[model samples]
Every structure is written in structure tokens, then in C-alpha cells.
Target chain A: MIWLVWRQHRKQALFALAALAALAALVVPTGLTMRGAFADLGLPDCVRTLGKAGPANNETCLTAFQQFNDEYQGFLLVGILFLVLPLLVGLFWGAPLVAREVEHGTHRLVWTQGVSRRQWALAKFGLVGAATLVIAVGYGLGIGWWLGPLNSAGQRNRFDPLFFDMQGAVPVGYTLFAVALGILVGTVWPRVLPAMAGTLVGFLGLRVVLATLARPRYLPAETLTFPIQGTAVAPRETASDWVLASGVRNASGELVVRGGSIECPPNATGPGAAGCGTGLGVEPGAYNWQLYQPADRFWLFQGIETGIFVALAVLLVYLAVRRIRRIA
Target chain B: METALETDQLGKRYGNTWALRDCSLHLPAGRIAALVGPNGAGKSTLLHMAVGLLRPDAGTVRVFGETPYDNTAALAEIGFVAQDTPLYRDFTAGELVTMGGKLNRRWDGTLARTRLAQLGIPPDKPVGKLSGGQRAQVALALALAKRPRLLLLDEPVASLDPLARREFLQALMGSVAESGTTVLLSSHLLADLERVCDYLIVLHGARVRLVGPVEDLVAEHRQLVGPRHGDDPIPGVASVVRASHTDRQSTLLVRTDGPIGDTSWAAHEVTLEDVILGYLADGDRPTSNEAWGVPA
Candidate 1:
């Protein structure tokens, strides 16, 4: 059974290897160049002085930071490739694993052998599942290494959805979930093209829902209040935190509106209007309030998200096994 | 005789319609039994059940007295070639043979390789590139290499050309002669099985209409000719399978255990095809036309 699985999926395995090599080729040189620029620009001192009043916040250091961002931010576009890698695994490796067999009627050939259908399904899922894990982990680590300088410099937030999805153990969970979903759909539908399409739609749909809706509520967000001055919010204070919501509150603590802008009453005189023109703190005792998941919770969120997807993957695989046993 | 495959009150349904219902039959070991039926007559359903590809909704299907559904031991004893003889298109015949060896506990790698070589099938060519006849042969070789006790084939020659069909059957017969394996092969075409099968199971309308040794079934049925105006029932005839009439004369296909005693009627021998067509023609018309000599 092992030999049969390898023989069948050797092409997919080779393609995945080639893709990994290509990813390494793209990241390695860019990473080295980015790291070199970080040291040469002395941006480490600027990052160290973040949120403090110091010489590192001076014009030269600020210009240096801007220059560093200008030179390397374009490389982040490559992250999109990593984003779709799990979907590719789901379509090519997982969907076709069973759908192709059934579509071509080869399931009749393989399932009639000495081995039971359970053994056949397990061997295929096990081998492909392991391969997907290795590829996803390798991809996550590569992206993590490539984005190290930008993340440390506060130019990019690790807690952001894009970076968070590609930086830790979560990619493994996502890939496994995608593959399991593909297998489950393929087992039930038994058509390669439709299974691939269903997998694509399902994987992307779940990812969107999880990232936008469920992620922010994984743990209760911490709140912070500060005087709403005329200036914009400081970047350093919210550097790596995932801000869920922000708004201005009235003196009685009712949220007048979301965001920092404020509107004065139409009959207000010059001084009152002038005060309102300076943004939300114009009203007495009102301040800017922010709801956010702080930077320290990065790993904890990663654990929670990964745990969710991994549990889903296990459930999908279990359903797939049960479904396959009843397939006619 | 030892039974190789047995189904008692087996049934299957797809959606609201039954694909096969009340299907019960026994295939004795070492007999090449032909399951003859028309399209949609549940031949494929019965074969799939026997091979464990389908689970019966009612009753049981057993191969060598054990349920074949998800049973590794029972599966090991049965080699099934489904309709179209499906195989991996990208794998070469040699690779397929090797795969068979790896997947089965009792594969004969040498036999598969030698047979393919003798058949002039290129070992390195992918099966998708092979001719349909060659693909069928390769599929057969893979199934044969398992050395299974019961070999079930569903319409193995339904899609092959005349030459390919003959060659495929020839190869099948050759292998069966050597192994003495019990074979149950189904086909809608009667001629495909008439020359090779000693036992016959006639299925129609998702039910078994007739089953017996070919020789006995043929011997028990006869064609009778008599006057159109006659008694309602004919003597010495166990059952009238089918009947047609002209204004002056009547012709009937009848099953009987004894000789026809009526001197006015002529009793002629019936071939296996005649008997099968007779049974297949049963229950196929409205009841209003079922009377004797009703011109249907």
C-alpha cells in the first residue's frame, strides 16, 4: 500500500519540492540583502528608542527608517504566494488524491485488492497529510526568517493577519485543514474538478471568516484610553497590537462615533467650534479609547488559531474516513 | 459442489428506485457462470455486491461463506474486474503488475510479466497509451496474478472490438483452464458467454428470472407449434415462457420436465439463446396481452 501511494503521488511530491526550492531561491537573497541594510542603516537604535523621547527619534534616524522601508517593503508581496500555497496543496495533492481515482474508476481496481478500503484511505491520507505538514512548516519558517528585520524594526506587525498566517505553527494547521477538507469533499463528490473548486471556495471562505470574525475574539481584548489630541495616534504604542476597535466617548461615556473625528453642534460659537475642530478630546472628560489584542498575545493567538484549524482538520478526516467506508 | 459465491435475499437501492431487489443465487466453485441480463437489469449491481464494492440494503452477500463487505480475508479470495476494466492510466503495465504484487498477499508477479510479454504489450508504455484491448488484457493479468479463488468480471468485453473481445475471452479461458478458478462474468450479449460458460443466471427487471446449468436449462425448454384455436391450457407443459400467434397457427416457447404428450402439437428443440430470450421476455408486457395466442 505504501509503495502504491508513493508511486501514485510521486509527481505531486516532486512538484511540491520544486516549489519549495523556488520559494527558498526567492527569499534567501532578499532576506540577506534586507538584513545587511538593517545593520548598515543603524535602525536597531531607532527601534530601541521607540515610544520614548530621545535622539533616535531625530530627523536622521527617521529618514533612515523611511529609506529602509522604501527599499524592502516590496518584498512583502511575495507573501501572497505563501498565502495560496495551502490552497494549491488542497487542489492538486488532496482533492485529486481520491477524486481522480474515483473519477477514473481506478478505485475499483485498488479497493478490490487484499487490503481493505480503510487501509487504502488511511495510507493515502497519512502520506499526503505528512507531506502537507512538512511543506507548510518549511514555508512558515522561511517567511519568518525573511520578515525578521522588518518585524523587529516595527515596519511590519507580526500580529497582522498577513504576517501572522505565514509566521508560526498556524500555517501547518491551515494546510492540514485544507487538505483534509479537499479529501472530504472529494470522497463525497467523487469528481476532481468539482472537488477542487469546492475545496478552493471552502478553504478561502473559512479563512476569511476566521481571520476577520473569530480571530479578534479569541481572547478578550485589552482596552486603553488616552487623551485625544489633534495629532494622529502614535505608531509605536500600537506597533504589533491588533487593534479591534477605536472610538471617541462622550463625558457620560457614551460612544459618540467610531474613529477620532468629532462633529460640533450647529449652534456652537467660535471657541466651542474651535475646540471641536481639534478632534475628539474637545469635549470635557472625553478621550480616545482602543480595544486591541496586545503584542504579547501573538504566540497565544497562534496557539488558539492553530488549535482550532487542527481540530477541524481532524474532524474532517474522521468524516472522510466514515464517508469512504459507506461509498458505493 | 462447494459454493464460491452466495447471496441470500440481497437487495440494493439508489434513491427511490431499486437497482437490484430480491437477488439470491449461488455460484458453485470451478464453474464459469455467466450472469446474462439487459442494461439496467442489475448485473453490475450484483457483481459489485459480490466484490464488496456495494453493500446490500437487505440480506447478505458472501464470498466463500464470509461477508465480502470490508472483509480483508474475503476480499483476498475474490478478484473483480469492474465494468470498463478500470486501471491507472499513467502507470505502465509492468508498474501495475508490480503494484498488484505489493497490494496482494498472493500475487504471481512472474505470471503477470510473462503473460504481458507474450501478449506483445510494451512494458514501459503507459496504460493510457495502450490500445483498449491491451488495457483490458493488462487489467485481466493484474486480476489473474492475485490467484483469487473466485474471479468476478462485469461486462469485461462489452466495450471491446470483435477481435479484442474474442482474444480477451480466449485469454480468460486459458487462465481458467490452468487454475480451475470459479468465474462469474456478466454481459448483456448472450453470444459472449454462450461458448464459454457452463452455468447460467438470467437476470431481468432487477430480478433473477432463471438459473441452472446451461445444458439442463436448454434441455428443459422447447418450442411448441399447434392450431390457434385450442384448449386454454396445454398438457404436459410446465409453463409457457412466451407465445405468438397467426390466424391459422400458434407458436409457443414452453418449459417442461416430460415429453409433450399431445400428438397434434409439434415439439422442437430450443437453443440456449431461445430459452434466455424467453425468460427475458417474461413480465415485459401489460397483463391484458398475456393470454395465449394473443399475437404478442
Candidate 2:
């Protein structure tokens, strides 16, 4: 059974390896160059002072930082690629795993062999599932290593949703989940094109929902309050804290609107319109706003998100097996 | 003889229509059985159920007296060739045989290689490049290499030319001679099966219309010619399968167990094709002009 699975999927597995190799070939040199620049140009010390530490008063360090960011524009595209890689895996590798067999009536051939359906399903999932995980982990390692300097230098937020999914452990979990989803959809739909389309749409939908709606509440976000001073809202507490929502409270203790903007009645006029009742106010501690999930909780959030996706992947595998058994 | 395959009121429905209904039949061990039916007559459905590829909506289907659903031991006893004889288009014939050996506990690798060799199929040639006949041979070799006690084939030669069909059947007969495996072959055309099968199961309208030995079925059903009877039942005629009556003469294909002792009518032998056609045509409203001897 293992040999059969290998014969069937060796081409795909080798293709996935080739893709990972290509990605590594591109990322390794760029990563080494970034590391060299970080050292040769004293960008580490420059980041220490000119980044979130204090004001950008040193012109030389600021120029170095700007040059570093400019040189790594391709890093952001790589990040986006990492984000879309799992969907591609689900679409091509996982969706077609079973859908192609069914569409071409080869499932009848395989299932009619001496092996039972359970055994066949196990062999397929075990091989393809493991390959998907390895590819995802390889991708995460390369992309994360390339972005390590930028992340630590405060050029990018460690807790930002855009960067979080492309970093440590979570990408592997996401890949497993996508593969399981693809297998489930392929088994249910039993058509290659439709299953591939369904997997792409389904994976993207789940990812969007998880990143936008679910990740923020993985842990109770901590709130920070500061007194309103002058017309300007002070900067956030830290550059790495994710600010989920910030709003000013009214006299009735209800959040009126976003913290920075203030609305006035149409009939209101003169200086008062430009002051407390209409514009930026200076009432100390009267209405403070909040930020969410700080940088320190990054690992905790990764663990929780990975846990959720891994659990869902296992459930989907079980569902796929049951569906395979139910096929007639 | 032990029963190789049996269905107890097996039935299946697709949406609002029944594809097979109460189709109970049994084939004894060591006999070559023919499952004859027209298109949509549920022959494939019945064979699929027997091999556990399909689930019956109504009743039980057993192979070698054991239920085949999810039972690995029961499944190993039967081999099946689907209608199109699907194979991996990318794998060479050698790889497919290797796959068969790895997947089946009792796979006969030497037999697979020798059989493909005999068929003039190169071991390294991919199935996609092979002709339809060669692909069918590969499929049959894979099944026979399992050495199953019962083999079920669904229109294995439907797409082959006459010579290829004859060669395919000859290969099948060779294997049957060596192994004595009970075979249930399904085909819409009885002429394709007349030379190979000894037992017959005729299906029509999702129901079993006839089940018996080919010789007994032929000998039991007789074609009668006599004066026109005008839609009335005649004495000594068991049941009219097909009838065509002219202005002065009537020709009727009837099934009966008793001897035709009537002196007024003459009896003629019924070919297997004629018997199959009569049963299938009887599915529609039988015409008095549809009998074999009468002109339309």
C-alpha cells in the first residue's frame, strides 16, 4: 500500500520539493545580503536608537535605515507569497489527490484491489499530508529567516496579522488545515476542477476569517489608558502592540467614535466648535482609549492559532475518511 | 455446488427512479454466468453491488455467503473489471503490476508479467499509449493475478473490435479453465456472451426476468406458430413473452415447463439471442407483430 501511494504521488512530492528548492534558492542569497548590510552598515545600532527607542535625530542612522528598507522591497512580496502558498497546495496537491481519481474512474480500479477503502485513504492521507507539512515548514523557515532582521529591528510588527501567518509554526498548521480541507472538498464534490475551485475559495475564506476575526480574541487583549493631553493624541505605548480599537468615551461613558476624530452639531459655531465640544479636546483622563494584544503575547497567539487549525485538520481528516467509506 | 454470489432482494434507486429492484439471483460456484440486460436494465448496478462497489438500498448482497461491505476477507475473494477498465495513464504496465503486488496479499506477479508478455504488451509502455484492447488485457491481468474465487466483469469487450473481443474472451476462458473461478459477465448484447456462458440471468425494468441454465432456458421456452388467436390466452401456453399475429397466422414466443402436446401448433427451438430479445422486448408493451418469425 505504501509503495502504491508513493508511485501515485512521487511526481507531486518531487514537484513540491523542487518548488521549495526554488524558493530557497531565491531567499538564501537575499537573506545573506540583508544580514551583511545589517552588520556592515551598523544598522543594528542605528535601529536601536532611530527605531522605536527614541526620536529620529541622527541623520546618518536614519539614512541607513531608509536604505535597508528600500533594498528589501521584495521581502514584502515574499511575505505575500508565503501567505498564498498554502492555498496553492490545497488547490493543486490536495484537491486533485482524490478528485482526479474519481473524475477518471480510477478510484474504482484502486478501491477494487485487495486493499480496503480505509487502507487506501490512510495511505494517501499519510503520504500527502506529511509532504504538505514539510513543504510548509520549509517555506516558513526560509521566509521567516529572511525577515528576521526586519522583524527584530522594528521595521515590521511581530504581532501584525499580515506578518503573523507567514511566521513560525502557524504556517505549517495552516498548510495541514488547507490540505485537509482540500481533501474533504474533493471527496465531497468528486470533480477535479470544482474541487480545486472549492478548495481555493474555502481555504481563502477560512484564512480571512481566522486572521481578521478569530486571532484578536485568542487571548483577552490588554488595554492601556492615557490622559488626553493637548490637541494631539499621544503615540501608542509600543510599536509592537496591536491596536485593535481606540475610541473616545462620551460624558455618558459610551464610546462616541474613533479617538482622533470629533464630530460637532450643525448649529454649533465659533471657537467652541474648534475646541472641546467639536474638535480635539484637552480634558486630562476624561476619555482614554485602548490597544490590544501586545508583542509579548506573540508566541501564545501562535500556539493558540496553530492548535485551533491542527484540531480542525484532524477533524477534517476523520470526516474525509468517513466520506470515502460512504462512497458507492 | 456452493453458491459463489447471491443477492436477497437487492435494490438501488437513483433519485426518483429505481435502477435495480428486488433483483435476487444466485450463481453456483465454478460456472460461467452471463448477466444479460439492455441498457439501463441494472446489470452494472447488480454487478457493482455484488462486488461491494455499490450499496443496496433495499436488501442484502453476499459473496461466497458473506456480506462484502467493509469486510476485507470477503472483498479479497472477488475481483472486478469496471466498464471502462480504468488505469493510471502515467504508470508503465510494469509499475502497475508492481503496484498490484504491493497492494494485494496474494498477488501473482509472475502470472501478471507472463500474461502481459503473452498479450504482446511491453512492460515499460504506459497505459495511455496502449490500444483499448491492450488496456483491457492489462485490467484483466491485474484482476486474474489476484486469483480471486469469483470474477465479475462489466462489458469488458464493449469497446473492442470483433477479433479483439474474441481474443479477450479467449484469454478469459484460458484463465477460467486453469482456476475454475466462478464468473459473472455483464453485457447488453447476448450475442457477445452466447459462446462463453453456460448460466444466464436476464434482467429488464430493474427486475429479474429469467434465471436458469442457458440450455434449460432455451429448451424450456419454445416458439409456437398457429392460427391467429386475437389476444386470447391459449391452452398449454404458459406465458407469452412476445407475439406477432397476422390476419391468418400467429407466432408466439412462450415459456412453459410441460411438453407441447397440441397437434395444431408447431414448436421451434429458441436461440439465446431470441430468448434475451423476447424478454427485453416484453418489457415494453408486447406487440402481436413483434415475434421473431412475423414481419413488422
Candidate 3:
């Protein structure tokens, strides 16, 4: 049975591996260069003591850090690839798994063999599911390694939706979920192209809704009050705070909307234009209250998100098996 | 003794239409049964149900006296080559045989190899590149490699040319001769089933119209000719399967157990094709033998 599954899907499995290999080729070299640059500029120690640097050293370290960061805009492409990798898995690997068999009338061939339909489905899911997880894990490790310096420098947040999904264990969950979604749609549609289309649309819709609406509420946001120090609290001190929302509030918990200054030209692109509306007015004793998930909760949030998607993947696979049984 | 295949009031419906309904059969073991019916007569539906590829909406179907639906042990005793003989287009013939060997506990790899070798097919060639007849042969080889107790084929040669169809059937008969496997094959082409089958199950209008040994069924039905008779009943006839009247004479295809000894009628033995056509013609109008005014 294992041999059967491998024989049927070796092409797809190899294709996935080749994709990962290509990504490795790109990230490995770029990652080494970036590390070399970081070390050569002596930015490691500076980044390690970023917050406590003396004014004179701070200026020089900041310039070195900017140069290191500017050397690799290629990471943006890698980010986009990780974001779309799950959909590619769903379309090429998952959707075609069952849909092509049905479309080509080959399901009848395997179904009528000594193996039962349930066994056939189990073998397929077992092999392909494992392959998808391996690819996702490899990708996760590669991207995490590539982004390690930026993250340690406090330039990238672990909680932002894009970075969070691309690193840690969340990519594994997303890959599994996308594959499950593909299988479910393929079984229901029983046609290759339509199932692929449906999976792409369904997967994108699910990721968007989950990331924007459902993810932040996985754990309650912590509330904090601090004195409104000169203009807008300087955006949070920690890059990974994952601020859900923050604004001026009176002691009674009411919002105080500050009006923009009439003296600034609207939508200016000049250097100081961004801060033009701030310092317009200040309410006495009013503090800037924040609702946020702090950086320390990164693992907890990762666990929660992965748990939800893995659970959904399991359900989709179960449903796909049931549908396979009923296919006859 | 367990029969090769049996169905008890088997019924299947597609939406508002009934593809097969109230169908029942008891095919004895070791008989090469041929299911003959015109297009849309539920022949494929019956075969599909028997192999467990289709679930009956009502009643039950058993292969080797056990329900095959999700029953691996029962399913293991049966092998099916569905219509068009669908195989993986990209898999080489040898790879498909390898798959068969891996998937089936009872698979005969040597038998598969020998069969393909005898067919003069290159084992390394992809199935998609094979001719329609070669593809059919490969499909049959895969199914036969399982060494099933009962082999079910649905129009395996439906798409082949005359020579290919003959070759395909020749290989099938060769296997049957070698292994004594009970085979139940369905085809609408009466010419195809005439020489190969001993038992016959004729289906029409989603019902079994005639089922018995070919020799017995042929012996029981007679073509009767006599003077014009009104829509009147005829004695010594079990049922008038078909009837037509000319200005001066009447021709009737009738089923009966007794000998037709009346001087008013000329009796002639019926051919299997004639018997099948008679039943199929009666298929459009639903009526039974008892409803034909035969005295109880």
C-alpha cells in the first residue's frame, strides 16, 4: 500500500522537493552574505545593546544597521513566496491527488483493486500529508534562519501576520490545512481544474479572515496606561508588541480624538510631515492606554494558531475519507 | 453452496429516475454468465452493484455469498474491469503490474508478466501510448493477476475493432480455460455473447426479462406461426413474449414448458437473439405473463 501511494505520487513529491531545493539555493547564499556583512560592520554587538547605546555610538550603530538591512531587499520576495506556498501546495499537490484520478477515470482502477476505498484514501493522505509537512518545515527553518538577524535586531516583529505565518510552526499548519482544503474540494467537485480553482479561492479567503479577524482574539490583549510623553508615545518601545489598538484615553476610559493642525499641508511627503498633526493639544493627566499582545506571548500565539489549523486539517481529512467511502 | 453472485431485490435510483429497480438473480458458481441488454437497460448498473462500485438503494447484492460493500474479504474474491478499461495513462505496463502486485495480497505477478509477454506488448511502454486493444489487454492482465474467484467485465471490448475484440475475448477464454474462474460479462452485442456464454441474464427496462441456461432458454421459447388470430389467448403457451399479425397469418414468440403439438400451429426453435429481441420489445409496455390472460 505504501509502495502504491509512493508510486502514484512520486512525481508530485519530487516537484515539491525541487521547489524547496530552489528556495534553499536562494536563501542559503543570501543568508551567508548577510551574516558576513553583519559581522564585518561590527553591527552584532551594537544591535545586542541597541536600546542602551550612548548617543554618539547610537548614531554610528544605526547607520551600520541600516546598511546591513538595505543590502537584502530579496527577503521581500522570499516573504511573498512563503505566503503563496500553501496555495501552491493546495493547487498542485492536494487538488490533483484525487481530482486527477477521478477526472482521468483512474479512481475506478485503484478502487476496484484489492485495496478498499478507505485504505486507498488513508495511504494517499499518509504519504502526501507527510511530504507536505516536510516541505513546510524545511521552508520554515530556511526563512527563519534567513530572518534571524533582522528579528534579533528588533527590526522585525514575530507577531505581525506576515512574518508570524512565514516562520515558527505556523507554516507547517498552513500547509497541512491547505492540503486538506484541496482534498475536500477535489472530492466534492471530482474534477481537476474546478477543484484547483475552488481550493485557491477557499484557501485565500480562509487565511485572510483568520489573520485579520480571528487571530488577535486567540488570547486577550493586555491593557496598559502610561503618561502621554511628547507626541504619540513614539510607537511602542518593543517591535513585537502586536498592538491591537492604542490611542489617547481619559481616566474615565473615553477616547480623546486629537484634531489635526490647520497649519500643515494635507498629505505632504516631506520628512516632518508625518509628525505635523501631533502635539496639537494635550489633555491634562490623560494617558495613552494600549491594548496589545506582548512579544513574550509569541510562542503561545503560535501554539494557538497552529492548533486551530491542525484541528481544521484533521476535520477536513476525516470528511474527505467519508466522502471517499461514499464515492461508489 | 455459495453462488458466484446473487442479488435480492437490488434497487438503485439516480435522482427521480430508477436506473435499476427490484432486480434479483442467483448465478451458480462456475458458470460463465453473460448479461445481455440494450443500452439503458441497467446492465452496467447491475454489474457495478455486484462489484460494490455502486451502492444499492434498496435490498442487497452479494459476491460469493457475502456483501462486498466495505467487506475486504468479500471484495478480495471479486475482480472487475470496468467499461473503457481505465488505466493510468502515464504508468508503464510493468509499473501497473507492479502496482497490482503490491496492492493485492493474492496477486500473481508471474501470470501478469506472462500474459503481457504472450500479447507481444513491450512491458516498458506507457499505457497511454498503447493501442486501444493493447490497453484493454493490459487492463485485463492487471485484473486477472489478482486471481479472483469471480471476474466481472463490463463491455471490455466495447471500444475495440473486430480483430481486437476477438483477440481480447480469446485471451479471456484462454484465462477461463486455464483457471476455471467464473466470469460474468455484460454486452449488448448478442453476437459477442452467443459462443462464449453458457448462462444468460437478459435485462430490459431495469428488469430481468429472461435468465437461464442458453440451451434451456432456447429450448423453452418457440416461434409459432398460424392463421390470423384476434388478440385472443393461445393454450399451451406460457406467455406471448412477442406477437405480430399479417393480413392472413400470425407470428408469435411464446415461452412454454410443454411441447407444441397442435396442428394449427407450426413450431420452430427460437434463437437467443430472437428471444432477446422479443423481450426487449415487450420492455416498453410493462406487463407480466399472468396478465396475458393465461388461466391460473
Candidate 1 on B1-296: residue-level lDDT in tens?
Answer: 89999989999999988888998888889999999988999999998899998889988998999998888899889988988999999999989998998899988999999999999999999999999999999999999999989999989999999999999999999998899999999997788788899999999888988888999999999999988835477778888888888999999999996888888889999889998988887554566655665765
Every model: iRMSD: 0.9, 1.2, 1.2
DockQ numbers for every candidate? 0.81, 0.67, 0.62
Model 2, range B15-56, lDDT digits (tens) per residue? 989999988888999989999888889998898788887878
lDDT of each: 0.86, 0.83, 0.82
lDDT of 1 by residue, A1-328 (tens): 8899899989989989998998899889989999999989998777666555543347777788789888887777767567888788888887887888889999899999998898988888998899899999898788888888888665677888788888788888899999999999999899999999999999999999999999999999998776544433343432577777888776777886686434344334345445553443346656667788988899999999999999999999999989888776
State which candidate, 1 or 3, has the greater lDDT.
1
Pairs that collide in candidate 1 are none
Candidates arranged by TM-score, highest first: 1, 2, 3
Q: Write out fnat for all predictions, comma-separated.
A: 0.94, 0.72, 0.70
Instruction: Name the 10 consecutive residues with the lowest summed lDDT in model 2 chain A.
Output: A229-238
Candidate 2 Cα errors over 4 Å, as ranges = A46-53, A56-63, A153-155, A230-238, A247-288, B230-235, B282-296
TM-score of each: 0.93, 0.91, 0.89
Distance (Å) between predicted and true CA of A294, model 1?
A: 0.4
Name the best candidate (by TM-score): 1
When sorted by DockQ, best at the front, the candidate numbers are 1, 2, 3
| Backbone-clash count (model 3) | 0
